[model samples]
Target: MRKPVLTIFYQYNPWQSTIGGIQSLINTFIKFAPDTFSIRLVGTGADNGQVVGQWHESELLGRPIQFFPLFTLLDDNVRKLVPTTVRYTAALLSKTLQSDFMHFHRIEPTLAARGWLGDKTLFVHNDIPQQMSSAKGAKTILWQQFPQLYFWLERQLMEQFDQVLSCNSASTKFYQQNYPSMVNRIMDVRNAVDTSCFKPLAPGPYQQAKQQLLDRLRLKPSTRLLLFAGRLHPQKDPLLLLRALAATPPESDIHLLVAGDGDLKSEVEQAIEQHNISSRVTLLGAVPKEEMVTLYQVSDVFVLSSRYEGLPIAMLESLACGTPVVTTDCGQGPSLLTSESGLVVSQREPQSLAQALVTVVDNPQRFTPEACMQAVSPHSAQHVVEPIYNSMLQRWHVSQANS
Candidate 1:
């Protein structure tokens, strides 16, 4: 009768890879607890508005979603006329009005809303400002120039939340240790993987297309493939992967496949060319979500040398596909994954990464689909998320009774 005490956020869309992990969880949560609760999503734009098989706001597993503009003030107005602090305040007020329980997946807007959204759950996915504070030379200087306003704002917001979810233990400790006042509300909810969709590829479209890709490349009969899929950016540290690949033996019978696009696509291409590893490396720009299963099936290992990540969706997909993975120990997730099903290299080290790649490529049998599946089984939507939804509803009921 009380409409199950609504859950909502200004972030989530099935099509946007930036928040794909969060979107997947929301879709699954809806499926697992549809009878008891309903979720409304508010974000920048509508995923269904686009052509070319755009993902519905809540289209996964046949769920429906509602969306609205998240920012109250237009960017143009904020940039040209109003001061940042004032504009940010207006945006926060608008977003707080939009949702009952707010999940701030990114930092900028979350920091802007500091100490405002009373009695709302605030989940900070990462300490982006703190991470940026440690950046090199020019970047570090730029971050320090702001007099740590964003960092202070983030702390203030954390203090205000009724509940906080950290994606990994490291980040959980980050907020707890840094802002001890928030320790009580912090919860550790690692990113969940969509096991049904991402599991081992069936012998259908993915297989057929993969054969065509291999034939087109004139790839040898027994070549091991390494894959990297995500935005092309310095934060991902893709250039490190390039340098690492070039150091390997030219005739190692291994190849690297990069799938996705971003501003640094040109730079990555140039790095591949400069290394003269053109034959061994291929970049497939921005493959759609439906096609990712095929990409994983056609590959041997998935590598992510990111300098930072909360928990990469691609890593989970690759593991689900029965493909092995090699990633740098940049964030908490990689270390948690390394011993169970993949390799974890040190951050920003080309030689260490190259060695790990070679190791995985040589011993493909070391990694199995079952181990990967077991690792991610706990994080599956049905297993971990249903309770969260039920608890949220129960908590809301309790709050009302007390009131």
Candidate 2:
């Protein structure tokens, strides 16, 4: 018998470096979903302006990936006007018309191709209106001018999906409130981590790893390491993290490890110089995913000062690595964090974040490594993927029966 096929549509290439939470979620799904389901990943080649109408084949995590690129014929300005989902809809549908199940990374694509989305599942990674409103420049102006129309379209698009999966309760609640008639279709399917790769290191190995990281950074043994891993953009608010570091006393043995890069790189450098905390902060720009596990294990605490989020994978990985967190109440941070795992401050202020960092590091015993690891056990790939796969199977079976 032939295996059932699962086709995934995403905006960006998931194989690229510095991937976000959505990519991580897709990667987990591709890695753990049963062999009975043959998966095909369709995405644009916008990263390199590769040719359109071509299917690129690659293997990730021992699974075959067939990527379909779109928008190659359009200019940058024209592509920007059309959302990635809309621009790539025809290409995606052309390649996956016979798929047993179609999975969308965002709602726009599902909306653009709704007529052909038989047995489809849409994943909501963030609050759509909030994300648009947070944009700067021309995009912000566009959103301001047509807010109602945009939301109406978003709601209509979302309602068409057979099942809507949200990465956090905040997103699920937003959708539920906006489309009350389709409340039953929305479900919270939290993002997950590779627990085997992120788990706490053994005592001897842990000490060795810590020493190696410290030596490489030329830091003292007594210095406390705080890690921030994400894009250095307005939404992530890396500037806020820098200001918080400035608020910390110079004598404090705390040091920060910035593990990603973005448009605000220069600003982050300037802030370090302006605050005179150059020695306390190290910007390791765009560290590979493989190295993140070590960084998490070596850090005293993982910190995130994002203005908003939809369940950050960095925070989840930090907890899985047995490191406590100090983050602003963004996305699922408020609910995912507890006294046993870490601290969640109310505001995204420098002083509040600094205080929380001090409290977490000063009283490290309060958040045990075991407790931190246990807190994220429910988000492990093994635990989260089974239910999602089962849901897909049930949906496919129902569709078959109806057919």
| Best of the candidates, TM-score | 2
* Tens-digit lDDT string for candidate 2 (264-322): 78889999999999999998987767898899998999998876677888888999999
User: Could you tell me the TM-score of candidate 2?
Assistant: 0.89
TM-score of 1: 0.82
For 1-403, candidate 1 gives per-residue lDDT tens digits of 5554344444433445432345445555555655555455544443334422222244435665544444332221112234433444455564444344555555455554464533466555543444555552223223345647766756555665777777767677777787776678887876666677778755586567667878887887667778888767555667889999988887777788888665567889899989988998888776666667777867878898876667776787788777778997766556557454788886567888888888877875677767777766666766666666667777767877887
TM-score of every model?
0.82, 0.89
Clashing pairs in 2: none
Which parts of model 2 have CA positions greater than 4 angstroms off?
Answer: 46-52, 71-98, 127-146
Q: Scored by CA lDDT, what does every candidate get?
A: 0.64, 0.78
